[model samples]
Target: MSEKNREGKRSARERLAVEREKRKAADKRRRALIVGASIVCVLALATVVGVLAANAGKSGKSSASGPATAPSGAVGKDGLAIPVGQDTAKSTLTVWEDFRCPACQAFETAYRPTIRQLADAGQLKVEYHLVTLIDANLRGSGSLRAANAAACAQDVGRFGDYHDVLYQNQPKETQDTFADNDKLIELAGEVDGLNTPTFEKCVKDGTHDSWVQKSNAAFQSGGFSGTPTVLLDGKNIYADQTITPAKLKQMVEAANKS
Candidate 1:
C-alpha cells in the first residue's frame, strides 16, 4: 500500500478508538450518577424512618400519671413525678432533697438505712421532693440539671433506675466536677429503662419544671428553710446525726399505732 493510504488507515483507527473511549467515559459517568442518587434516597429514607421511630417511642413512653395537682402549693403524687416509693403504703414520709446539698447526702447515707427498713417492712412510704432552692445559686445548676434529667426519666417510667444511677455517679458539688446537661443525659442512658434522647429533650425543654417549682413552694410552706427536711406522716421531723434507727422506728411505730 502507498504511504498516504497507510497513514489514512492509521488515522481512521485512532478516531474510532477515541470515540470508544468517549462512550466508555459517558457510561461511567451515568453509572456514578445513578449510584449517587440511590445512596441519597437511601439516606433520606433512613432519616424519615428514624424520625418516625423516635415519635413512636415518645408516645409509648407517656406516663400514666397526669400532670401533678399542686394544691396549697404542694406537689401531688398523681403526676409523673417520682414519689420516692410505691404509692400504696400504709404510712407516708415526704423528704425534700437538694441534689447538691451536702446535708441531703448525709441524710441519705444516715437515715437511708432506717427509711429503707421501714419501706421494706411495709411500714412506711417515702416521697422524695426535689427542691431547687440551692439551685438559685449558680453553683447548684448541676443539681438542677440532674433533677430535671431525673424528672424526665420519671416521666418515662424509669425514675427508679435513673434515680439510683444519678446518686451512684453523682459528681462532686464542686465547680470542676459539676454535672452538666450532657452528663445528665449520660446518667439517663446508664439507666436501663430510660430513652436517652427523649429524656434529654425533656431536660433541655424544661418540661415538668412546674413540679420542681411546686416542690420548692412546699419547702417554703412547710417551713423547711433548708434541705434534708423529713416529713413523717404529714408532720415535719427534725434531728441531727444522733437520730438513730431506734428513734426512727419508734416514730414510725407511733404513727402506725395512731
Candidate 2:
C-alpha cells in the first residue's frame, strides 16, 4: 500500500477516536447531572428536610376550604395544569414541579431547551402543574408564593416565559428567597411585558394561591415521588437515569412517527 494511503487511514482512525472521546465526555456530564440534585425524590426529602410545624399544618388544605381560582387557559382535572404549546400536538408532557426546589431548577436547566423545542414544533405539548413541595418540606412560603406567581403569569398569558425565568433565578433551597413577593415580581421583569402593574398586584395579592394549593394537593395524591416529576405521555421519564435531551428528542420524534 502507498505510504500516503496508510497515512490517510491513520488520520481517519484518529478522527474517530476524537469523536468517541467527545461522546464519552458528554455522557459523563449527563451522568453527573442525573446524580446531582436532579433526581431527588420526595420520600427521601421528607426525612432529609424538616418542615416547620406551621407550614405542615396547611399542607392538607383542600380547594373547598377556599376558592381554587384557576388562571385563564388552565386545563386538566380541576384545572390544575398550566398548558404550554399547541393544543394540536400529538404528545403530552406533564411536569409537576416547585419553583423553590433545587432539583426542579436542575431539571429545568438541563432539559428545558429540548422540551421547548418539541413543544414549539407541534410535536409535544407540556402541562405544568405547579406544586408547593418545598414550602411543605422546608420552612417557608417560597414554594407557595412562587407557584402562585407562576399561576398569575398564566392569567396574563406569560406563564411560559415567567416559568423559565423563575427557574433561572432560583435561590438557595435553604434561603427561602422566593417567599418574597417583591423578589418574584422583580424576576418577572426579566420577561418582556411580564412585570406590569397587574402582574405585580397578582404576585403581592396571591391571586392564584388557592389554585397553587389545589395543584399541590393533586400532585400529592398522584403518588409522584418528587418535584419535577416529568412524564411523557403517562410514562415517568425523570426516574429513568438514561434519559437525555437527545433521547427525549428521539422519543418525541418516534412518537410522531407512530
Candidate 3:
C-alpha cells in the first residue's frame, strides 16, 4: 500500500475512536441525570407520606372518643351510669335513652319514682346508658350536648340527680334547647351543688363530648333501634306488648324473685 493511503486510513480509525468515546460520555451523562431525578421523586413522595401520617396521628389523638375515668362509686365504665343500687341486688335494669326524646321523657316521668324507689330499696340496680340518636335524626346537636353535660355531671358525683332533673325539664324535641350550654347549666341548678363554675366550664367546653360519642357508638353497635329501650335482667321488656309503666315495678319484682 502507498504511504499516503496508510496515513489516511489510520486517521479515519482515530476519528471513529474519538466519536465512540464522545457517544459513551453522552450516554453516561444521560443515565446519571435519570438516576438523580428518580431519587428526587422518591424523596418527595416519602416526605408527603410522612406529613400525612403525622396529621392522621394528631387527629386520632385529639378527636377519637373513648372511655373516661369513672366517677366515685360507679359500677361501670366508659360513660355508662353507675348502678344505682346495692351491688348484691338480684335484678339489673338497663335503660337506653336520649335527652331530646319526648318518648323518653314520658317514660322517665311515668317510671322515675318507681325506678328510684326500687333502686333505693336495694331490690334492683339500674344502669343508664345515654345516647345521641335524636341528634342524628333531628339534625341538631342537642342530644349529644346534653349527654356530654350529663357525663360531666357524673364526673362531679351528681349524675342521678342531674339525670332526673334533665328528664323532668326536657324540652320539646323540636326545640333543640339543650344545644345551648347555658341552658344546660341553668338546668344543673335544679340539682344541688351541680351548678358550680367547674361544672359550668365542663359543660361549656364539652369535656366529655368524646365520651358521649363513644357511648352512642356503643348503643348503635348493640343493634338497638331507638331510645328509651328498657331491659329487665337482660331481656328487652319494651319489646313485649305486655310491659307498661305500671307493670315495670311488678316485672322487676318478678325478676328479683326469679
Candidate 4:
C-alpha cells in the first residue's frame, strides 16, 4: 500500500477509538446518574416511613396524668371497669376501646363469648379502658357520653353487663346516637337496675365526663394507636400478627400455662 493511504487508515482508526471511548464515558455517566437517583428515591421513602412510624408511636402514648380514678365499684384504680374474674386470675386482658369505633364493635362482637367464658371461668381478668378517639374524629359526643354512662353503671355495680349492652347496641359510626342521654338511658335499661333515676341523672349530667377525658389521656399515654388494642399480661397481643379472634382463647390458655 502507498504511505499516504497507510497514514489515512491510521488516522481513521484513531478517530474511531476516540469515539468509542467517548461513548463508554457517556454510558458510565448515565449509569452513575441512574444509580444516584435510585439511591435518593430509596432514602426518601425510608425517611417517610420513619416519620410515619414515629407519629404513630406518638399518637399512641397516654397523657402524663395517667388514667382517671376508677368508679366507686370498679376493680382497678385507673377508672377501668370492674374485672370479671377472680382477683388471682392467671392472665390480665386489658382492652382499649371506643364506643363509636366500628373495629371496637367488631372485636367485641367476635370475642365477647371467649372473653366472657374466660372471665366466668376465672382464667383471666378483663379490664376495659374507654377512649374518645371517635368523638374527636367524628366531632360528636357519643363516645364520651357512652363512656360516661358506662362509668355510671360501674357506680351501680353493673359495669360489665352495661359494657356488653353498649357494644351490642352500638350505633353506626356516623350516627351520634349515643350522644343522646335518653338513648344512653334506654341502653342502660338493658342491664337491670342501670336505668334508675340516679343513673339517668348521671348520664344527663355527664357526671363521668371528666373521668372519660382522663381515660382517653391515659390511653394516649399508653402508646396505643387505635381501638380494640388488646394486651395480654401487659404484652401487646396483636403486635406480631400472630393473634386473632379465633386464637385468643388458645393464647389465653398458653398464657395461663406459662
Task: Pick out the ten consecutive residues of candidate 4 with the lowest summed lDDT.
Answer: 50-59
Weakest ten-residue segment in model 2 by summed lDDT: 55-64
At residue 181, give the lDDT of candidate 3.
79
Top lDDT prediction, candidate number? 2
Q: Score candidate 1 by TM-score against the native.
A: 0.62
- Estimate the Cα RMSD of every predicted model relative to the unseen true structure: 26.4, 5.0, 27.2, 17.4
**What TM-score, computed on C-alpha atoms, does each candidate reach?**
0.62, 0.81, 0.70, 0.70
Clashing pairs in 3: none
Give the lowest summed-lDDT range of ten residues in model 3: 51-60
- In model 2, how large is the Cα lDDT of residue 70? 93
Tell me the RMSD of model 3 versus the true structure. Answer: 27.2
TM match of model 4 to true structure: 0.70
Considering lDDT, where higher is better, how would the candidates rank from best to worst?
A: 2, 4, 3, 1
lDDT of 3 by residue, 64-88 (tens): 1433534445456553565667788
* lDDT of candidate 1 at residue 182, scale 0 to 100: 61
What's the lDDT for residue 247 in model 1?
83
Candidate 2 lDDT over residue span 105-130, tens digit each: 78887788998899989999999998
Total backbone collisions for each predicted model? 0, 0, 0, 10
